[model samples]
Target: MRRDKDSKAKADRHALLAAAALQDHLARRLRMPGGPAVQPSLEPGAPMTLAQHLNLIPRPPPLLSEDQWSEVHLRSRLRQDSANECVICKEEFQTGAQVLLSCSHTFHRHCLASFERYSRAKTCPLCRAAQYQKRPITDGQDLFRVKCATRIQAAWRGHAARRAYRELRRHNPPKDERLRKKWAAERLQEENDRLLSKMEDEVGDLDSLFAELDASVAKSREVCDAALRPLAARLQQGLLREAEAEAASGRAAGRLALVESDTVAPAVACSGQQHLALQLGRAGLGVSAGLGAVAGAGAAGAAGSGGGEGPAGRPASAAAVDWDAVVARARARGTQDCPICLGHISRRGNEGIAWLSCTHCFHIDCIMAFEAFELASGGTPCCPVCRSGYRRRCFT
Candidate 1:
């Protein structure tokens, strides 16, 4: 019985191996026709998948928001007038929509539609005022007020003239022609004097508006600086101290800590002893409002005189700066050679030269050479201390 079971097991194992070989032969036959080959049909510029095609084409810009579109339309109408010609299309204005500007220039409504659509800031074709609304540097209403006042005076004169004509007709009832003409001339002169007085008052109002605008912009910077000074000092003491310490370890030690010890260090001074502070508290008092200080510019007008021009009038604060001494000290403190020349300016050979107030001084011959080079480039030839652009009379 044991011999018979062993024979059956060996027969079952041989049958299983034969079946496996048959399956492998069938798989090989199926794969043999293709054998790892792949075919491709896509040509150049052919449409890809939906995602690829969408990515290949450039996307248009985002459309303007509803509020922005409305603003553009309003601004366009405000800037152009109904009767003016469009600069772009050179067309006449139409009734349903005429573009009008704040400057009183007018244009055809449709001429600027595309410009308003795509441009970030569409300007009036004539005056170049941008589409967005801006606060007037001076009162805008004052201009219209002046116009209205002039028109009122004109209307009053016209009415008075007609009354004078009627009165002459009533009294004389068609007398000699010379008498009627003489009466008309006398009435016109009387009307002119009254209109002139009204016009002068309107002019005075406009002047006051301009004065206020100047005062606002003039005081803004000073107020901002004064408010910021304390905060700036705190930041410099805390956040900037580490950076300053690191810089001092390097070559910049001489240029640090010039400020009043409590505030920021001055740029020109290296140490506390070298700092210079000059206070001019009288500047704002009795100041002139003009661009440059005019001693008493608006004395006749209602606008109060502006503050003095102050230290700003000086060229880069160099009028008060002692450049020659600063350069000598900087050279003495410097371990490196001068930035302009490779040679050490601290040494006797180069030390004889004095720097100008512009902080660009060099040897006399060096200035001449620099001037020649500047002339060749067609740039202003200024002194090295203040970089004051002056012509060099002699060439090296």
Candidate 2:
């Protein structure tokens, strides 16, 4: 009877409600018979935390923290709501006797009394709470709110996950691995072929251009050589004529030396020109007489000695220089080639004409280039035509 009263008092004491759900107190350290108090660490490994060492289990859900429990009236909520039917009696609330526990589950009062009388323990059949508070009401408002919150959270989280999935899709590569590599290889090969073709075409064009230039040069050289042949023959003829004239002059000098100053030989066998000189000689005196005498003797020698005539009908003794005629021809040939540069000397522009003391003419630019070449070679500049010492003057 004493054990039964103590058990009833213990059950009543455990059933009272607290401000919030009561968590189990931490276990106290154990003191062995041979040593001081020691906290047990049943778990293994280094740097184990106190909870991990104790190996605690997690709390049940709705898992509200102590700070989050402020608005909730634990006792009032327990009294206000419970299951509509009693689980123990298997009857509805109107079945004459019903009980509400702190866990908000319902049971019949006589059913609990009969259960406690026959059983040693006081566990509630509905929730299996060993001890709990009783109230007189039943409600389902909080349960409904929890279910709605769960559904809303689930929907929101699902939407967020779908959005994340779409964003991740952007990372997918357009081509498969093998195809991407194949395309890269093909591009490389095509570029190489294009470059090789371009290089070959350029080389062929370069070779053709060089061949054309070489042919043009050879043709121009042949034309120049052909043109020079007639000019060469003309030059040779002029040189021979000059030599003959010099010989005639020398012969005239020799004959003049043989003539007597006072005697007038009647049978002079002279031409009209010789007779004129003889008359002048006889009439004149001193140096004038000597000049006339020499002239007459020269005319006689020239007429008697037989020689081929040069150029036109003229006395052989006076071989008038071909210089003036050549200069006039050059001036008339306005677009004539320069002897130095082989470029034309035009009369209309800055180049106009330039001349040397030797009577050689060329374009001003050509003369200047020739002068530069001579200066570089450390030699005196000269006319390219006659090779005479150059004394240059410009017309424009």
Candidate 3:
């Protein structure tokens, strides 16, 4: 009986200890800050773990600072207006009693008081500005004033934000746009100058080529003239001999005729024959002189036609190009247009005007282009207007 009694006592002690431990555990789980009460009965599927039980505990809402509370009350007190509207209840103020928040929103005094007491964050209903500890309300009118002031503050902040946005938008683009336009203009000017320089270089090259061609043509003509000179001289001499023989034969025949005429004395006839012979001799001399003069004139004409030497014995092609004469003729045409291009001529040295031997004028570039086309077509360069051969004479 004693042994049974001791075992029963030990089991009872263990039971008491187990119950106390469970109670302590329950108390600890329930002791969370702002936590909800836990149920006495455990759910079936799984027992609550310590971590899961702790997670179920609610966290208290964050408290506002004293300064924040003071600011909200001060701004609210200053926002009074006659037309009081309650933002929380969405109703007009009938008793001239309202509350305001630092965010400048208005609400009825009763509504704000209830909201401050119950709201988790103690913030304004409309603007969500945090409210701190409550203050003693002196009067309902003051609350109304605060509400008006808060509304005004909120409106002011909105207005400031809008103004800043507008000002920012207005002032931003001109600097970037000005830079872009300036850069573009500079690039365009550079391109124009480059093109002008390239054109000038091309014109210079063409002028040099024309000069070389003129020189070559002049040399070829000189060679031809030199080759033909001896032949021309021999031909002239043969012509002179033929003319002399013809004159001599005619003189002899005239004298014989004078002798044969049958009406006179011998001495008179002899004198008449002598006078006829003298006249015939003078006529033959005149004929010979005339032949020489004719031959000389023909030679001079051929030399002139073949481009004779100019001043200082320079070839005609090597002589100074008569740009002045070309200009004058171009002006006489009464229009600034080049006949070949039918475009206005600049008369500037760069325009490269060339004049034909016939004095017809064209732009040098135009003439060169046409000549190239003609050469490509297996033809020679000639005057478009007069169908005359082109001569490289009037260029500088």
* TM-scores of the candidates in the order shown: 0.21, 0.21, 0.23
lDDT by residue (tens digit), candidate 1, 51-71: 232333322233355466556
Tens-digit per-residue lDDT, 167-256, candidate 2: 664444337888677666766797999999999999999999989988886797567545544443343244335435655565435544
Q: Could you tell me which 10 consecutive residues in candidate 1 have the lowest summed lDDT?
A: 295-304
User: How many steric overlaps does candidate 2 have?
Assistant: 3
Residue 324 alpha-carbon offset, candidate 2, angstroms: 36
Q: Give the residue spans of candidate 1 off by over 4 A.
A: 1-178, 218-223, 236-244, 253-396
Pairs of colliding residues, candidate 2: 82-138, 82-139, 100-135
**Higher TM-score: candidate 1 or 3?**
3
Worst lDDT run of 10 residues, candidate 2, spans 17-26
What is the full ranking by lDDT, best candidate first?
3, 2, 1
| Each model's Cα RMSD | 39.5, 28.7, 24.8
For each candidate in the order shown, give its overall lDDT on alpha carbons.
Answer: 0.41, 0.48, 0.51
